[model samples]
Target: MRRQRPIRLQHGTSLHAIVLATAMTFSGASALQAREAGSAETSDTQVRLPENAEIQLAPVLVEGQERSAGQYTATVFTGAEIEDLGLFNSEDVLRMTPGVNINSSGGTNLSSVFIRGVGSMYLSDVTDFMVPMVIDGAPINARHISLGTLDVDRMEILKGPQGTLSGPWGLAGAVDITTRKPTRTFEGYGRAEYGEQGQALLEAAIGGPLTDTLSGRLAVRYSQSEHWVTNDADGAPMANPSNFALRGQIFWDGKQGTTALVTVEHEDVNALPNLLVLMPYGRKPSVDLTPGLYDDVGKSLNRYALEVNHDLASSRITSISSYMNASNMEIAAYDRKIMQAQSGYPSEFWNQDNGRESFFTQDLRLSSLPGDTITWAAGLFFQHMDASYDTPRNTYGYTSPRFRDFKSNVYAIYGDVTYPVTSALRLTLGLRQNWSSTDYDASFWRGGVGSFDSRAMSESATTGRAMLSYDLTPGTVLHARYARGFAPGGYNMYAAQIADGEPFGGATNDMIEIGFASESEDKTFALTGAAYVNWVSNNHLLAYDSGTYVSSVVNADTRSQGFELQGRWRVGGGLELAAGLSYVDARITSSVFGPSDGDILSGNLVPDVSPWSALVSASYETALPPFLGLSSPMLKSIASYSYVGPRPANPQNSLDLAAYHKLDIHVGVAQDKTEIYVRASNLLDDMYDLYGYAVPAANMAYGGMARGRTFVAGISHRF
Candidate 1:
């Protein structure tokens, strides 16, 4: 885990004296290392962990190859770990990582993936994510990062600001997911599952050789579930979810040291989770919704991509081209009683939104090959996006419609170089130059207010990072870094007036991080600790009007500081212990507060973020009896405990969520290619808020709590 600077670890220049550095370099590949430790040919400068180690670090990709094990900064999950943990989506996997938290406002909006207590914090139909999620060398909005994950080879979550190499929406960091490629040998697998509330899932995949130099893989998954909270309005299951996805990939191993891959994918999702229960007062939790209301949302996506990697005498060249399209529709209801701490009259309103978006991106890069003393990678990137939105609403029996045509373009050059100062010391420098433009035209009826068109917004920013790493011992390392990240600002189409869009400004963040990673000589113990601080200005924040049910975007200044510690221990026998802790202090440093608009004050904790989070998990494996009638039978079990501190629910500090903890246990029995397991969720049956917000003037706090106590049984097999 990586964290803000602890002020104790420094090299050369004073940590606080870190200037706007230049020439930071990187070539990421997080695959496991088969070579001995301290090998110069190793692409991963982090820790080289043993196979049985507990915690995983982010991958370091060098010359199209992956190197795994520990990174002083970042986290990683290999394909095997994904299956073992039964991780199905971004939330599932990220929950196990330290210093990462997932918060949602509920609905079709994408969940905010917060790192070190910093995130977009608010989600609406038209909002864009501040973090970049890379899939198969293609950069898309953080949309699919939480949608689904299938046939993935590895996942790497780099903490803090990763603006230099992966440039789009780098205000936070980056999440890179590499899908499994077709192999020369035939291999396939199937899985089926059933859970509480009529939950069911089916998934399958197959890949094999199609020709002497070509191979193909195809995978599909379908899942559906009933809402945990029943809708008393119509005695129906509201917030039900149904999702389907398909992917086909082809890989070619051609001429001398050359490889190419092509991928096509499609996905459809339907669900809107803004459902809330009816709890009139300080009574017991009543899991029933208001009368005459429901939530519905649908999203569809299609993606096509091509990637080529060619090896040169001393370097590797990569070219990637990708195009994707997505469409979303949402018809959801809002309750005026939301966040009402005291019982009051029930008020209801509903709105609908329909939109389509398309994105095209191209990237070319050259990097050092293995065995090179100096590691470096440079790339040129270009991206174009076109989107259209149609939002029609009916609040208090009044009709309002809004339309927007939006376009965005980006161009950039970024590179990183890593040089070993000596056999035990290293310095890295990375730099990125980016230019972006956003244009949008809006047409609408803002109820009593008039509508207007949007203005053009263009901005240029230079981002870079400098890292200094020194070996404390052969198995220990200390590192400190300085990084800057940026995101272009744009019009908030959902705004009621043109003033909110005419001269919007972008957001920028600068950070300093220091941490260390250490491994036991015998490769049985590993630990990582980090600390970091961020300085941000002109950042977008969610502004809501409880009366109009309109959510706006406003610019604000904030500061976030945090620290993390994670470790793994492999005791004797087949038992392992893993634990991690994170603490973030995020607050609004300065902002123009408005009573009816943003409605937030300085010194308030950023809404929806918890200051303290912790995780503890244990795993064990043992042989099964011969009476099972299967060869090499094994039984495995894992138990996890997570704790989240109380968090402010809204900007006004009117609503606060109580502290909560969740315990889960999973046990499985395996024989050859097949495994059967049962998982218990929320073993403690703890009920807590999923999303919360303050009413315009309700002066009361209210929100929905997650369902308690559920179980799922599943079977997986590989063929």
Candidate 2:
């Protein structure tokens, strides 16, 4: 029924040990960048940075006095840079970045981002991922990244287990997206774009001061696109997709150190599963089938947030509260093809998912100010999440409906302290005590198991981090860190047992990392590199039997060891060159599942992980020469080539997707605040298996793919 699983079925589904672990430090990241939101934790290892940097993606938080300047570089990227790169969506922000990537997951509303080969691949309402996404000061759905960046200030990505800094997620890593806040002075922005595949987009934002003490901002984005694929058999247009987002915010900077921010956002998305393609993805890939009563996938989300803080002479007090509600619906042919059926319209095998989700979180903390010699921050965090979904199937007319209801709560006390032991050496320590519990109920009308409320699952865990940083120079730093990662245990709602539901075990990572950052004296050249390994225990995986069309979830031990190198050089004459490389070796070490899978699946490469990834790019911006007899206008061009190595497609490791390269180029001419540009993604039009699976019994194969070779021209202006 599903490849990313969250679907009704799939035949399903790492570890290392350790003395020393790795903790990600984003200029002293606590709970990823969540610490940047309200906690004032500081480390001298990082120097203040400029706004436009590429390392700023992943799950992070940006707000409050706790937020520090760019350091530990490449962890931050500005909205203007995002626009310059032609990276419009949340998915592109991470996937296109170095040291991080996302596996194939176009068939569902959820996709996971992998950091150094450690991340959750399959996701559902009842399941939690290794990484989490945060916006402003509040935690929100990871999928909201689809909302685009028309109103964004910056994005921050933190790698490694970050449980010691926050709660509920971040067993692997975290990403934070900070939206643009109202400025003291009035400002406005507008952008419009049209492209291939019959697509159009519009974005607008206006913000300014409303009063002496209050400022407000409004932003909106809308996009629509026609069929990206054609039904081979009937030549019918299909796979239409659309998106819309609206946001409003108010910021207050009051007297006596008090400040507050209130935000509201709504986003809607509709898309066809990208998996509706033939598996082999031959030279001329096509669906090859027709006439199915299947519907597309849809999602809606609403979010509300409030943040308040009081700055003290030496310390700061902060509070953040957030609430989110989202709905997901899917009614599609699981097989992605039309087959002869007994009834009219051939509707017997379509799958339906009516899933709903809600999340609420609150964090309060007190900490020394940002520049304190021994900076420290501590906070209390709490969260409650509720999810319920109904999966129904129809055999011509008879329906077999399965329902699942799930609930979870988390409580945590986290703190971090940074101090300098020597003039050139800095040390940071952090700890978090997390308490969590879960309860779930399941129903299978077709299996005769009416409804079963299983036993509740609960546990307590302690995660911690330690790091040492040395200044190679003011612009250069070398660091080492150890961290313990954790994610809560939860029910595999889709593949759970009907009678005695079993919840997958929580996952943990003991990671150790050593890295260095350096730059030239002129600030025109920069370089960063790191090496690390993650030992994952109880990694949740999927196990599917092509013969039975059934799937189950299991836990296994695995390990991922990798390294990354990134560099940038701003050469003379309006030329900038940049490059990045990353490599990971992820392998399963143990197997525990017995029924659908057993010892046979052990010693396999982790599925959906690319072991080698690299990219190189060049950007040039120069003024037009007077020979044209025109006033000064700028000519800009950016080009990059990326290579992603192959990996196994499934838990069984029976098939491996081939390696492929992607090329992107952008060109624009501009003067003043207006720009007209054309950007081409995947210019090579290379087609390779993004995901691959087979039904041995039917002698059939299936997979998903990216939209290859598309061109878009756009104009943007600001005042």
The clash number for model 2 is 36
Candidate 1 on 1-719: residue-level lDDT in tens? 12111111111222222111100000111222112121124343333433433233222111011122112256666665565445667666665555666665344444666677666655432335466677876777664554678888777676766645433446777677778889998998998999887778899999999999999999999988876665545676666778898999999999689999999999887774554443322323433445434434778889999999899999898888999999887654555444233235465555666778899999888877866768777888898889887776655444567778789988999987878888877888888988988888887674566566866778898888888888889777788889888877776656555554554577788989888877678656667788899887876677767666566667778888998887766563555556678899988877555646345677878776788987666666666776557766766566666667777765555566666666666677777668788977766666556656555354433456655667899998887
Off by over 4 Å in 2: 1-75, 124-127, 141-147, 166-169, 288-296, 335-348, 395-398, 447-449, 496-500, 593-600, 626-630, 697-699
For each of the candidates, give the backbone clash count.
34, 36
CA RMSD per model (angstroms): 9.0, 7.7
Candidate 2: worst 10 consecutive residues by lDDT? 12-21
Which run of 10 residues does model 1 get worst, by summed lDDT? 20-29
Candidate 2 C-alpha error for residue 488, in Å: 0.8
Candidate 1 total steric clashes: 34
**TM-scores for all predictions:** 0.86, 0.87
